[model samples]
Target: MGQQTRAHLTGRKIYGCGRCGTHLTTVEALLSKRFTGKFGQATLFYSVVNVLEGPPEDRRMTTGLHTVVDLRCLKCETYLGWKYIKSFEQSEKYKENCFLLERALLQTIEPGLELEGAEDPISREGNDSSTASNLQEEDDDDDDDDGDDEDE
Candidate 1:
């Protein structure tokens, strides 16, 4: 086996997957914390890493109609949140191309701390279907609530 490539963020504070503790984004990428997600409070970020974007879906939110793609942790396939692809409302265009990470699904990783499961190169490959299935079961319940509230 070869050395695995890891994308670790260098910051005073880092946000990672709550389940897997894989680095997602840092405080520098944070845009706002007034957004809401399926689980409740969400945060807007300018960018994120180590995430997979699901298929885009049109959902009518309190702000307006938006096309968003759900984001999942690459290491654990945990449902983190979604990214706004297209915003129909002119006033809401600022959210386009922004990532929304659910606070409920994030864990704060302090500086100098090694990420959990960072050494397991197999997990980064994302080939474990069984593990993903189990971790996603609870998140599936939130899918029915498509009409999410607006982002402040």
Candidate 2:
């Protein structure tokens, strides 16, 4: 298979693959958070990125029967959710072409935001603070020596 290029999403609130951190979608594309999936809580999105759709299948959901294709992360190939291809019931027709992402399987990515199972910058800084303070104290001692020379 040829190398697949992953799509990058830009926004204040971006959702990514929980395991690989591959960009998925943004808050602006989110439609609703009141959906359920195999894992439990799920969310609906108007569009998504960096995903691959599997074969479509007819599944009977709470509302009605829907033709959906399972979606996987394009980078890691992890199953994230599914996309509605068609709805049998008229009341659920609005969900067609929409994507349903499982919340438990997704990670929210933001600037300076610490991701779960990832290294935290704040804790790393804390570990090096003592060394940084020691260097500052040495600089202060040199300043004091300058004052002593002036007195002489």
Candidate 3:
């Protein structure tokens, strides 16, 4: 899921992996209502990633009934949360797109360059803030020199 939007949720971009600053998915695709258990207050949503479910030993997981899939960071391989293959409702079967939100976070689209595995995005002013600040300071110094010349 790249970008999702709901009629009610306008510009509500909920993200995960705030520390690593990785983009997982949005809240628009939430299927089930938010619940709490092994994970904190979490909800399920749709994901294009291969959502699988099983214990470590039984890795041959499938989207069978009552199966749980692990949601990982696409970049750092960090554990984000799990996904329910089926809906919590007994009647519903494998029809719902349910991905868990273990550590769901809110992210903003920073107006800057996008780099993979980057904690902080480079600002729009320039990729090198140090160089930009130095250039600004030099400009200030030039203004001071102009003032001094006028006085002379």
Q: What would the per-residue lDDT of candidate 1 be over residues 82-148, giving only the tens digit for each residue? A: 9999999998998899999887677666666687644332244555342333324533343333343
Tens digits of per-residue lDDT for model 3 on 1-152?
57332111122443434334455554455454334424343444565242224352212223223555566555445565666554444554433445655433323323231424334423324443432233234333323221111000
TM-score of each: 0.74, 0.73, 0.46
Residue pairs in candidate 3 whose N, alpha carbon or C atoms collide under 3 angstroms: 45-99
lDDT of 2 by residue, 3-92 (tens): 977766677667777667777887778666656788766667889988999999999887878999999988778898999999999978
Residue pairs with backbone atoms closer than 3 Å in model 2 (clashes): none
Top model number, lDDT: 1
Error of 3 at 52 (Å): 8.3
Give the C-alpha miss distance for residue 65 in model 3, angstroms: 7.1
Query: Which residue runs does candidate 2 get wrong by more than 4 Å?
Result: 111-152
Query: Cα lDDT for residue 124, model 1?
Result: 44
Supply the TM-score for candidate 1. 0.74
Among all windows of ten consecutive residues in candidate 1, which has the lowest summed lDDT?
A: 130-139
Q: Which ten residues in a row have the lowest lDDT in candidate 2?
A: 143-152
TM-score of model number 2: 0.73
Q: Distance (Å) between predicted and true CA of 42, model 3?
A: 0.7
Best-first order by TM-score:
1, 2, 3
